[model samples]
Target: MSETKTTVFRDLLAATKDGDWGKGESRQGHVPAYVIRGTDFAEVRRGCIAGVPIRYLAEKTVHRRLLRADDILIETAGGSRDRPTGRTVLISQEILDAFPGDVTCASFARFLRVDPVAASPRYVYWYLQYLYARGDMWTHQVQHTGVARFQFTRFAGTEEVPLPVRAEQDAIAAVLGALDDKIAVNERIATTADSMCDLIFQSRAQQHASVPMSRLLHPILGGTPDRKNESYWGGSVPWASAKDVVNATVGVLASTEEHITETATQNSRAKTLRPGSVVLTARGTVGAVARMVMPAAINQSCYAFEPGRMPAAVLFHMVRSAAKSMLGMAHGTVFSTVNMKTFDHVEIPNLPADVLNTLNGELASLHQLIVSHLQESRQLATLRDTLLPQLMSGRLRVKDAEKIAEEAT
Candidate 1:
């Protein structure tokens, strides 16, 4: 067994600093940098650094909060009803390289500089992830003004981490890092595939004058079963909500976090769509789009569209482009919602069948690649999630994890 000892969470860190929001635009004495918020933790982990707002900061603060490889960012605030605060993301050179300038955490996040002499930085990051996955971080969170805030000082001052010797830490980190690296590569592959489909759409479909997206695909509604009925939930039927599309790393949704029973589908209005149906979120998180890779039922919050006579990928990107164009139509004080009538204002290429069908084979191939990669990454993430706590708690050996990791990769 690997020898281990309990240590304060703060003791493993050489330093910790709160993040900054700085100025939203460039100004005298303000240097432009990427501000990483707690909201970005999910996207950043998936390797999509695009859309991260660049804030101009005082040069001195930028110097003080400059991020480095192996450093970790902890979310200090920004929790939701479904998700607690205290999420963490590890910084890597590849992520930093994605930005053209300096990178720093946002006001609601803080950076933890690991003490490499005490513990492997990657190992500490994996352990933090394990803790968050197991809901241990919720213990350190408190509500203030209806928002969840992580008690950083309290957590750092009191929480304990089981620490193994430096050598064992390195070994454990290596095993976990291998899994994440592969997952990251797969994510990149999936995103690139989707981008290729979009590029093809632009090149081939742009010449057409205009066609209302609604003319091609009709909106189909989804449903939710009674919450009080246990049999209605958690079955083989993949039940998708807006979050499933909003959080997808790639444009392909091969699986969902929640599933429903066939009984739920038959008893309720939740109609199941066949594979290749493109689902666009119509409420709350409106405009988020994904193509279903399997037969799935959706909730009322989403609208599913069949490919009809056109290619699935073609329809997917067309709907995505139109939804983005008509985003202003989705409006509400509480939850942003979209109506089918908004599509009349949204225009897409009116390309003829001869030109459109020519690109169908290639687009379908790319979509399939995206689906396969996403499905594979999902499985890899499952393996990592399963192994994380076992390895962190010293219940599973690094060598044993390495064997499983090797088999998965």
Candidate 2:
């Protein structure tokens, strides 16, 4: 093992700039650009940027703040008490390739450009992730007002970064990067499988009796556990709100931002949902549906349906189709308030056993493959997270870490 030195975090940065969110519409001096908010960091890290908002920015600002490959975007503002604000995402050419125009972080975030010779940019980004994971970034966050903010200047100038030599940095990054590359490959495959399953369901779900939506799903009512009681939250059970459902782009809800205790559910209206249940948002920005991959619960804004004796992929697309019809009715005569009675009036086609059963064999096999990829990605992610801090701190040698990762792979 070799000894490593430390450097002031800001010293490695060649440049840093605050971001801009200009007028929504095009101005004389402004051009259209995709704005990356703190919220988009997770998806952007995964190589998916579909939800990154588009906003116009002054041409000069865009030129000055334009994101390049290897830059790091930090969330300088907007975090809750539980989550710290110094969240960071590494920019890549792949992310830029997916976009049509230039990219910039929103006003709430800032971007850092590290001189590659001074520090490996990917290594620095992973160091920040390591910092956040182990509660080192929490001290940088302060809540004087409503939104918690990260003290960027102080954090950069005062904090010492564990600096390994360039060769060691690259070696460490390469070992971890291989795992991420696998995760990205899995994501793309699962996403394609999701698309194929949707097409299969749409093509086959026809010529059936139209029954009230309630009969098929028997919609389990979702309710919130009392928030003030600390015992009610942050347990093993995943809890889905409307936001969770809407954010699930591939029709699979693998995790949630919050969790509730099994005890909380037993004491409150929140019910524990069975695995393979299809969850749908019934109110507020409606019509998003996803199959819960694990045992979970939901808040009042969503409904959970156990996919009993049917392929959950079938229910996933069906509920989305039903939600669209229900939303259409709401737009016409019914108001925004959707309830059990609302589901009763709006009919959904019965799952014709023969047709869906035949389709079921195909869809179930495909859905299982997607879920398998997701599970593998998750396990790889856990291994990567475990290896990170030890590698960054020089506690785990890059060669030894590679051996562990090889075994996992």
Best by TM-score: 1
**Candidate 1, which segments miss by more than 4 Å at Cα?**
228-231, 328-336
TM-score, candidate number 1: 0.94
Estimate, for each residue in 92-139, the C-alpha lDDT of model 1 and write its tens digit: 998999888899999999999999888889888988899899998889
lDDT of 2 by residue, 31-61 (tens): 9999999999988888888889889998765
The list of candidate 2 runs beyond 4 A from truth reads 206-212, 224-249, 254-268, 283-285, 309-311, 326-337, 345-347
* TM-score computed on alpha carbons, candidate 2: 0.89
Backbone clashes for every candidate come to 0, 0
The CA lDDT at 332 in model 2 is 25
Largest lDDT belongs to which candidate? Answer: 1
Against the true structure, what is each candidate's TM-score? Answer: 0.94, 0.89
